[model samples]
Target: MKAFNDFADRVRKEKREHYSKPVSYCLNYILVYIYEPITLNQLANMVNLHPNYLSTLFKKEIGVSFSEYVQKAKKLMKRNNS
Candidate 1:
């Protein structure tokens, strides 16, 4: 059981690292196009992902919901006058 648990942990870590690129791309896109309207479905299409899969992967990799992350980024941009 202990060995199985360790393997599971390792797999989850690897999955997170593997998913980082798509998450990073989404983050950068949101920042660069912060002023433009965007939706999860639209982002999913842009990233060649299914909306549900992207939503789960994004929350797992980013530690927040997509909308929450976008809102926080927009707030920071506004404060910085960007």
Candidate 2:
């Protein structure tokens, strides 16, 4: 029974991690095109998330505002010559 409980816990953790990856990837994808001079509403529609929800998730996971994250990602990409 203890082993079964441990397995369940591990699976739950893995599932959460898997779900989080796509959210992070989506943020990165959005950041990549953020410089194209589009409105926030348009980007939100493209990503299929509510603008408010996307803002909250971006802040929680990336430790910054969405705009800030885009700046940081652009800086890092430039540093890496990407």
Candidate 3:
């Protein structure tokens, strides 16, 4: 029973890590390249996901549309710089 429980925990952790890779990469990329023009297609291609699916997934994971997040990030950066 303990072995089975441990296996289940590991499986759950792996699943979370797998699904988060794209979102995580996207978060880092946007922050690092905040000033660069970023497009869904470009990020989707980099993450090897379909653009439409990535758009949906990104929104689901990040709690905002990609463009909205980028705009917010830009605003925050500008305010910090000023």
- Models 1 onward score TM values of 0.72, 0.54, 0.76
The 0-to-1 C-alpha lDDT of every candidate, in the order given, reads: 0.88, 0.68, 0.91
Error of 3 at 38 (Å): 0.7
State the displacement of the C-alpha of residue 53, model 1, in Å, after optimal TM-score superposition.
Answer: 0.6
TM-score of 2: 0.54
Q: Which candidate leads in TM-score?
A: 3
lDDT of 1 by residue, 1-82 (tens): 9999999999999876675777888988998899898789999998899999999999988889999988998889899995
Give the range where candidate 1 is weakest over 10 consecutive residues by summed lDDT. Answer: 15-24
lDDT score, candidate 1, position 28: 84
* Per-residue C-alpha lDDT of model 3 across residues 1-82, encoded as one tens digit per residue: 9999999999988876664889899999999999999988999999999999999998887779999999999999999999
Measured on C-alpha atoms, candidate 3 has an lDDT of 0.91
Clashing pairs in 1: none
Model 3, position 65, has a per-residue lDDT of 94
Candidate 2's C-alpha lDDT? Answer: 0.68
